[model samples]
Structure formats: C-alpha cells, structure tokens
Target chain A: MEITPAHYTVLSAALFSIGVIGVLVRRNVIIIFMAIELMLNAVNINLVAHARYLENLAGQVFVVFVIAVAAAEAAVGLGILLAFFRNKETVNIDEMNIMRW
Target chain B: MAEAIAFYTLAVLILGLGVAVITTPKTVHSVVFLVLNFLCVAVLYVVLRAEFLAVIQVLVYAGGIVVLYLFVVMLVNLKRAPEAHEDPRRLARLGLALSGAVLLELAGIVVYSYGRVTPASAPAAAGPLTGAGNTEELGWLLYTDYLIPFEVASVLLLVAMVGAIVLARRES
Candidate 1:
C-alpha cells in the first residue's frame, strides 16, 4: 500500500500520546523534560509530513524554528533542574511544591 | 511497498523508543533512549525528503541537545531514587485519565478532519519548491521569507543561553 499522510498522522498521534503519558506519570523532572521533547518531535514529524504532502516548504521551515525553540527550552529547563537539584538534592517533581497552594 | 515498510518500521522504532524514554527507571537510561528516539525521527525525516531538517535533527537534537541532557543528568547526581516520596493528595490516576482524554480528543480531530477532506482529494497547495537542493531551498527561504523569525530565534537562543548560565551558576 502507498503510504499516505494519514499513516504519518496516526504515528505522530501515538508518539505524542506516549509523550503525554510520560509527562503525566513520570516523577523524575529530567524524564519529564525528555517527554516534553518527545512531544515536540511528534509535532515536528506531523508538520514535515504535511509539508511533504502539500509540496510546501513552510512546514519544514516551521520545523526548524521549532527545533531552535526546543533547544532553548531544554537549556533553560535543565538549568532550572540543576538549580533545584542543588538546593534540594533531588530530581523528583513531587517535591517541587514550594509554591503549591 | 518499500515506502510502507520503511514507514512502519520507523514508526514502530520511534514509538518504542519514546515509551522507553518515559518508562525507564534510571534517568541516565531514559536519556539514552531519548537519543535513540531522536535518531529514529531524523531517519523518518530523511524518508520524508526533508534532508536538511534531518541533519538539523541529528545535529541539534542528537548532538547538541542530547549532550546538554547528559551533562545535566550527570550533574544532578541521582544517588537516591527520585520517586521515593509520594504526595498524599497527588492525583496520579486523575492525571492519567486526563492525558487519555487528550489522546482521545486528538484522535477524534484527526478522524473528523480526514473524513471531511481526504489527503488524496486535496489540491496540491503550490508548485514544488524550486531550488538547487533541499538545503539550498530551505536556506533561501530561511534567509528571505523567514529572515525575521530566523533572527528572532537567534535572539531567543542568546537570551536562553544567558539565562541558563545565570540559573545554573553557583551562588558563592
């Protein structure tokens, strides 16, 4: 069978759901960050697939920007993780309730 | 036939690695799984003919971002399991149910949209992007039409760099 955009879309959705489950269930802050990255990658896959199907370069361009932003996010997020780890010596998100009401 | 096979194989690998990244007990192992997942995505990009983005995925994601993750993983020092403590009022089951709802909503949107306009029926948006190569065409677009966003992304990266430094620095 010829591969259509739906195949890619379904695959992207499955990957994204896994990322969501990761973010929700995982307690490690670092792993949660990785899950967030997984979600970003899923979006990128969808964009690229649609771009290819539509013969548009815009989707690919958006993917580039997404990667840049993801990098920036990872850097800042990991930096915050380090700062928090230094203070509390743990990477657990449950303990991240300093400001919780 | 070949294309379908490739897509299926890559999709399985990508989803499997994604699951591994999230479910692994060790943070370091999770990072390793994440790198593999990224590599698989990069390969999928190649299959989709976005060679430039594939290279960027491998370089920026597998190369730069994964290294950053590894460094952070090392620095955080996971001497003790991070999941030892459970908040008494935490709604873990609720969170899972909510996420499942999100998945169902996304799937619904996909089915609804596909039903209205099939991908096979839609007119091709425009002529194929013309240029010397994938990288060249992408680069031209990046410099010309997308120059503003490109420049803004650079500035964002700069700010993030400075902020990361400040955030991670020791208070002596």
Candidate 2:
C-alpha cells in the first residue's frame, strides 16, 4: 500500500500529542523547551507532507521560516533560562513564581 | 514497498524518541533522545523528497540547536532534580486531561479534513525544478517570491542574538 497524506497527518498528530503531554507533565523548564521543539517538528512534518501532496513549494518555504523562528526562540529562551538558573539555582517550573501575584 | 518500510521505521523511531525525551528523568538523557528524534525527523524529510529540508533539518536542528541545549544543560548543574519540587496544588491529572482534549480536537480536525476535502490530482507535468534540482528551486523561490520574509528572518535572527547576549550576560 502506498503511503498517503493521511498517514503523515496521523503521525504528526501523535507526535504533537506526545509533545503536549511532555510540556504539561514535565516540571523542568528545559524538558518543556525540548517538548516544544518536538511539537515544531511534528508541524514541519505536516507542512512537508502537504507540500508534496499539493505539488507546491509554499509549505516547504514556510517550514524554512518556521525553522528560523525556532532557532531564534531557542536562543532567547535558553538565555532566559540561564539567567533564571543563575538567580534561582533551579530549573523547576513550579518554583518560578516571581511574577505570580 | 521500500518507501513504506522506511517511512514506518522512521515514524516509529521518531515517536519513540519523542516519548523517551519527555519521560527520561535526567535532563541530559532527554537532550540525547531529542537529538535522535531530530535525526529521525530529518530522515523522514528525505523520505518525503525534501532533500534540502532534510539537510537543513540535520544541520540546524541536530547540529546547532541540540548543541545549544547541551550547553545549557551542562551550564545549569542542578543540585536537585527539578521534579522534586512539584507543588501540591498543581493538578497534574487536570493538565493531562486538558492536553488529551486538545489532542482529540486536533485528531478530529485531521479526520474531517481528510474525509471532506477531495485530494488534489497529482501534477502530471514536471514543475520548473525538474532540471534545476531541489536546492536550486528552493533558492530561486526564496530569493524571488519570498525575498521580503527572508530578509525579515535575518533581522529577527540578529535581534534574537542581541537579546540572548544581553539576557545571558552577568550584570556588572
């Protein structure tokens, strides 16, 4: 049997679900960040699959932009994480309540 | 037959590594699993015929981003595991339920789209990229149609670099 877009979509959904679970369940900020990356990967899979199915390059083009944004996000996020670690001496999400009113 | 086999194998590896990244107790181990997951995704990109994207996935994700994650993991040497300080009031079960709802909603959308939308007929004639190769086609489009966004992305990266440096620098 030939693989279809549905197959790719299902895989993307499953991977995205796992990423969601990771973000929700994990207390470590770094793990949550990694989960976000997984979610982005899942989205990229969907984009590329659709690009192939639709016979268009737009989806792939968008994926390039998505990757760029993800890189920027990681850089800024990890920097913030480093600063947070310096001050708090921890990476636990629950303990990061300085802004909580 | 080979495509099917390769696709399934890569899919399984990607999903399994994703789960391992999340469930692994040690942060460093999670990062390692994440690298494997990225590699599998890159392979999937190759299977999808996006050769350029596959290479970019490996270079940017596995090489650049993963190393950045490893650096942060090593720099932030936690005295205690982050999981130990879970607040009693934080409802883990509720979070799981909410995420399950989101998953179900997304799945429903996927099913609906597949069922309702008529699949577009595959292109019979080869597009412009048939002779120029995937990377060349991508570059031509990137420089022509998508030039504005491409430049914007560069600006965004520069800003992000400055912001990261400022954020990470110790206050004098």
Per residue, candidate 1 scores C-alpha lDDT tens digits across B87-145 of 88888888889888888988888888887775565435344653466899899889999
Model 1 TM-score (2 dp): 0.96
Mark the 10 consecutive residues where model 1 chain B has the least summed lDDT.
B122-131
For model 2, the superposed segments whose C-alpha errors exceed 4 Å read: B119-129
Fnat, one value per model: 0.85, 0.76
Q: Which tens-of-lDDT digit does each residue in A42-65 have in candidate 1? A: 999999999888888999999999
lDDT score, residue B110, model 2?
82
Q: Clash number for every model?
A: 0, 0
- Cα deviation of B112 in candidate 1 (Å)? 1.1
Which DockQ values do the candidates obtain, in the order shown?
Answer: 0.79, 0.77
lDDT of candidate 1 at residue B141, scale 0 to 100: 89
Please list the residue runs of candidate 1 whose C-alpha ends up more than 4 Å from where it truly belongs after superposition: B122-131
